[model samples]
Target: MMTCLCDAFFDDVARATHEVLESLGIEVIVPESQTCCGQPAFNGGDWASARQVIRHTLNVFQGDCPIIVPSGSCAAMSFHGALLAHEKETDLPQVQAFGARTWEICDFLRNGLGIESWEGRLDARVAIHSSCHSRGTGTPEAIRTLVGSIAGVTLLDFTQPEQCCGFGGTFSVTFPHISGSMGRLKIDSVRATHPDLLVSGDMSCLMHLNGLAEKQGSPLPVKHAIQVLRDARVTPVTVQ
Candidate 1:
C-alpha cells in the first residue's frame, strides 16, 4: 500500500516517523502542502477557522493511500475534527472520506500491519508521556505495546501516567498559569524516574514538557516514540 505521510511539523516528530516507516520498508510519501489540522483553532472553540484548516488538509490528501500521521493530536484532528468541523452539511462527505484514509503512525504500524513485536536493541531506560488524546483513544497502550517489543529498552511508568501535560494547543496560550503548573507536575513525575529519555506520540506534548524540563535543568531528553523504535532497528557494526 502506498502511504502518504501526514507530517505535522511539530519539531522532529515528522522526521522520526518517516525514518520508522522506511525502516519497516513501508512506502511513504509526505504531502508537501500538509499543515496543521487546525487543532489549536478547533480546541480553542473556533470551528470556522478549523474548517478552513481541515479543508486544506483534506485537499492535500485526496487519494486512496493510507494517510499516516506522526502526531496523535493531528491524527485525532484528521479522524474527528474534519468531519464535524464544518458548518455546511455538504462538507461532511468529503471530510469524512479524508478521515477514513487517515491513521496515526503507531496505529498504522501495529494494527494495520499486525506487527505484534519488533526486533532491536536499546539499553536506555525511558518514560512515555502520553498526549491527552491517548488517555481516551488508547494510544498510550498501543505505544507501550510496541515499545515493550524492543529487546533492551526499559519502559518506566511514571506517576500520574494518564494525566495531561496541559498543552491543549491554544489552551496553553489562553491559560498560561494552569498550563505551566500542569506541565511542571508532568515533568516532575518523569524526572523522578531519572530515565535517559521521555517519549510520546505527540510532539506538542514533548515540546511543552521538554521546555519545562530544560528550565528545571533536568538532564533527560524528550523525543517521539518513533525515534526510539527507529533507532532500535539498527544493528551497529563494530569497528573492523
Candidate 2:
C-alpha cells in the first residue's frame, strides 16, 4: 500500500520500495486497488474531502500485509491524520483500523521487520534530508539506522535537517514566494553538507530540492533512500 500525492513520482517510489523488499527476500503484496492517502486534502485543511479519500483508500487495501508507504507524508496521513479524522467522525471505524496498519518504508524496515543492517555499499558521501512528515511520525532515527546499514557510505548530518522543503502539495502553488524561499533555504542546507548524494524518504521534498539544485547548477545528486539502497544491492560486486 504505497500512496503518493504526486502521481508522476509514485510508481518510481513504489518500484524502489518493491525492489528493496525483493532484494531482502521479503514478499510484498500490493493491492491492485489502493489509491492516494489523501495528504493533499488533509494538509490543505479539507478534512471532508480527505476523509472521503481515506475511506476509499482504506476500503481498497482492506486486509493488508502491514500497509507500507514510500512517502512519509502519505504514511503520516494514513497512520495519524486519517485516524484523527476517523476519531472525529462516527462513520469511519474501518479507516481507524486501516490506519493502525500503516507504516512508512523505513519504519516498516526498522520496526516491522527489525532490519538492523543491509547487505550492500554505496561507497560515496550522502546527506539525508529528514522530511517534516518523517520527523512528525518519529521515523528519522529509523532512516538513519537504515542508511547506516549500507557499507562504505558516509551519511553526513545537515544542520536543520528537518526543515520543510515547502512542497506541501498546494503550498507551493498557494504561496509561491514563501515556498520558493523555503525551498532555497533547504537547498542551501543541502549544499552546505556538500554531499555527493542528497537522499530523503519523501519524493515531493526531493523533487522540490532537486529542481532548485538543478536550477542552481549544484553538482549534488538527489535520490530516494530506497533507490540508493537498491543501487548498492544491484551494483556488481568486485573481488580483489
Q: Which digits, one per residue and each the tens of the lDDT, describe model 1 over residues 1-240?
A: 111222324445567677778877887787767666777778888888878877777787888888877778777777776666764667798888877887777878888877888777777787888787655664677788887778777888899887889888778888999999999998889888988778888777887888777778864487677777777776621111
Stretches off by above 4 angstroms in model 2 are 136-138, 236-240
Report the C-alpha lDDT of model 2 over 36-62, residue by residue, as the tens digit.
888788889998898888888877887
Could you tell me the TM-score of candidate 1?
A: 0.89
Per-model clash counts, in order, read 0, 0
Q: Model-by-model lDDT, in order?
A: 0.75, 0.78
Lowest summed-lDDT stretch of 10 residues in model 1?
1-10
Q: What is the lDDT of residue 48 in candidate 1?
A: 83
Q: What's the true lDDT of residue 140 in model 1?
A: 71
* Highest TM-score against the true fold, candidate: 2
Model 1 gets an lDDT of: 0.75
Best by lDDT: 2
Pairs of colliding residues, candidate 1: none
Q: How many backbone clashes does candidate 2 have?
A: 0
